[model samples]
Target: MSTSDRTWDVIVIGAGGSQAQAMLAASARGGDVSRWLAVDRAWRPETKATTEALGMTTTALDVLTSPQELRELLGSGRLVANLAGPYYRTGTVVLDAAIETGTDYLDICDDADVILPMFERTEAAEKAEVRALIGMGSSPGTTNVLIRAAVDYLGSAEDVDISWTVDVNDMTDAAARHFWHCFNIVDPDGTIHPAPSWEQLERKTVTFPGTVGTQEVIRLAHPEPITAPRFLPVTRCSNFGAITPIESLVVAWSLAFSVDAQRPRPDLAEVTDHAIDVFRTYRETRPATPRIGSGMQIDIHTDGNGLRFSAGADTEMAEATGVPAAAGIVLLLDGQTPNAGVFSPETLVPADFFTALRKVSRGGGGLELHRLVNGEQTERIRIRDLLSQTAATPA
Candidate 1:
């Protein structure tokens, strides 16, 4: 095939956001540059410069409304790393195209509604010989893997608690959409649950040391609760999002109320866009302290042999999200994942996922792995140290 007609080894959708950039950079960190490409509806100069600097070119392909175009685009790529969201709207479109075109896929989707439906496409993906890994980002991705690690450590898990702190100082459309979607969950009563929820608040004192230490986290229906139980044999699973800059809670609730009251509204995208613009301007006038970090923690409760234990991993969000995502892409490209099927990160990522991720994130002695027996901390491990042990051991 001519160079113009050749398929790209990796195609990243939505190349504008920080997370997407991080993901793309991580993908390029230890891989061939000629085979990677980035796609977005349109490119800002900075985004173009950023991708170019990383040794990848950019293209403008607005395929959101064009399924045939999406199919063709995905067909021309070996693996598609979709970073566009709120994924409730764009996920299935790209995923459907990937399966139809026999293209492997990975996404940082954390929507509970999208996850179950994505899982339902398993048969189709398998039949098409396409491999897919869903929710491969921080909270759901890293948390899910950590919970599995804990489960293995405890023989089995009884309960799993996932929590993360998202500092929304950026005030960009991407950040706005993230918070907006968090409140898009429909309750059993058919009402939209207000997020940054004060009613269902949980006061978590610091158990781990980090930037997000000691905060009031609220219940924001996340995919981890819905999907983690399927793999871990847990009776209870819950996920929480603790938002920084407490005032943002008001903004989240207002957006939720407006969205809920206008049920059947087709202009939801416009609304979010407007809110983002408003917040962006507000942020410009009142610049907040630049946040240096964000993190995720997974705490698992397990009972076996009349004893209870807690085990988990704690790492900054960048390593937690970007590294796993990059690792998934590497595994997919390296044929380390399943032959064919739609699967969650926890399901397909091998035990070496952390090791692969640590290498990609360059997280030397950074990620803390811990296990507590009956509330008394017993084991503490650094990820780099753990990986060294893994590497030294015979397979």
Candidate 2:
């Protein structure tokens, strides 16, 4: 289909926290107004109120069991930004419908199971001429892009390391809950398996830039395990999760372990209710505090003679995670990405995409990049030029 015939520039499915940020970014791009639509199972009063406050429109949609309905809703939109999560549970159905309708799709999915299945279905997507971009959120999202960019910087990165740390105090209830659910689903076998991102690193301890001091980090099963190796042919690649105050890390570890233990025999209704209660409690208690409750740090290390690169953002966990996904969709809508089937964030986005995202900080959010050359550190605003070749796409 031609670009102009694409009626709605984008159709965002699900009005969750991430979708809100994506929709807002899409609208802010200075295009023809009224070219976007927000669809969700139920009308979120809070989101509805916020959209009305900002002068946008939202429609109700359930893409899971309603393929016919979703096809009608998709109509001639060129892209669909999906923010529904725990991806293992709800992602496939919507993606299937999009593939069937030949609509390019993007989502912030961080589940390995989800990625593996999607990879299995790549042929179908290709056959339908659809592009499915997955894992566009923070750790798996921007972090994927960073590693790709960094690998391109090094002539041929034989070894790569990726690590992430979040200051939990800054996380919103919704963000924290989404994270907790991912942990639960990944470790449901009741085993604290090594992180997929860190499986190959012999040494897992490194100091973050800006004097955060040295801390030990370990690879866990995150979305990166599935996405990174596809783009970068590194002998070793690892991803980790860390938090400060030690206590917060302990609590996160405990909660993850508990979920792993209970998931197999979980009482679905009870678990859902408990999750809701926890989210509500976190929302009420955390944001009022003066401390910078949550922030994220990302580090990427390479093999051979190459500079190590790290980048991060200080903001609420939700924004840290959501903003990048939104930025990715904006790039896709603007035709910045090539028409490819079943791509990941790192595979499709350019280094400048991160630059643009960093420039447009909402709610006091900021991004910082650090480059270490032969143990000498340099700080910079734009790392795209420094690492452009690493993330360059083959023609």
Candidate 3:
């Protein structure tokens, strides 16, 4: 598309944590001549001020009632980066707008209920020629891509298993609160759906990787469970929880239980105040330990031909979450994504995108892929072999 056709190189939909990271990364690339627009339910004066401080523009757009307005605002932007959430409640409308406008769409969604409907909309999106990528954030985003990368190394993957954990405290003030609210809404019944870690009917367990051993992790239903099975022929696909500690999980669980624990109601002022309090507490109690801030650990295991292939990474949560989505945007803008349909990160994003992402991840965080044969672990493996293995394996 010509520069005029792509009026805005990137149009970011929300002024939240992940959106900030995305805008920063895109701007840093510098040559693309990109402009960012931050839109939210209410005018976030603080976020508007922050974006202006960074030299960007901000707009106030209510996601619920502004489709034509959003379409008009999007104009000729080549892509839309959605950062709004409790996605199960508020994501599809934006996706619908993007599809109608024929603009490429991407979001950092991790909600299964939200995604299943989006996936079902793929044919409509394709018909409209709109490329929509879902779950482009950390866990559902890079974690999914990483697992696919590792499975490709094993020559043939018979089954695939994945795990990811984050210290919720590592997120920015707004992000932490957004996550808290989402957790509360999803798990309010005192039972986290799709348990954090489960095996059998996808049984759940908590185990630490490498030196830490495994700790008790609650099983929660995650989008990955739903998306992976539909796309990959693996017999079993599951996600496990590994939050900071039992204490942290307990606190989170408690908040999930309390009526208004993390809900973003009462008023914006109250939400903001509560978010600040949570941030301050995490800072005071956790401090800024080198490895603690916001780190993610992802492990993928596949068994085939009497061999096992696995890959895992321990890195800053922000970078892990931001980079993959940024990379996906790059691919989408460059006309690299093959289809104009709704798809999960792993299903649509190519393997090379991860390789390109690693090159740019130099100072932020590091990613490693591993291979294990007959119960032995090695630091590296071939990507082609891994994909070959998964492809060769029976569904």
Report the C-alpha lDDT of model 1 over 59-150, residue by residue, as the tens digit: 87765877787777787888899988778788888999988887889999976667777888999998998888888887677677666555
Evaluate all candidate structures by whole-model CA lDDT and list the values in order. Answer: 0.66, 0.61, 0.58
Identify the candidate with maximal TM-score. 1
**lDDT of model 1, residue 2:** 17
Winner on lDDT between 2 and 3 is 2
Worst window of 10 by summed lDDT in candidate 2: 194-203
2 or 3, which is superior by TM-score?
2
Q: Sorted on TM-score, highest at the top, how do the candidates line up?
A: 1, 2, 3
Task: Write one digit per residue (lDDT tens) for candidate 3, span 1-395.
Answer: 23346657778776545554554454445334336566666655665666666555666787777778888766667788887765766678888888777788888887655666787788988898888888887768766665555544433354555554565455455545444444421321233332121122222553444433455554544667666656654456655554565456555544433424433356755655664576558646764543433333444445422223232345556666666677777767666665668877666444556544654454434334455554344557555555444432221
**lDDT tens per residue, model 2, 19-123:** 455446544553443677767778758767665454456788767777788887776688887887657766787788788777888888876656777776788
User: What are the TM-scores, per candidate, against the unseen true structure?
Assistant: 0.84, 0.80, 0.75
User: Using lDDT as the measure, which candidate wins?
Assistant: 1
Model 2 vs truth, CA RMSD: 4.7
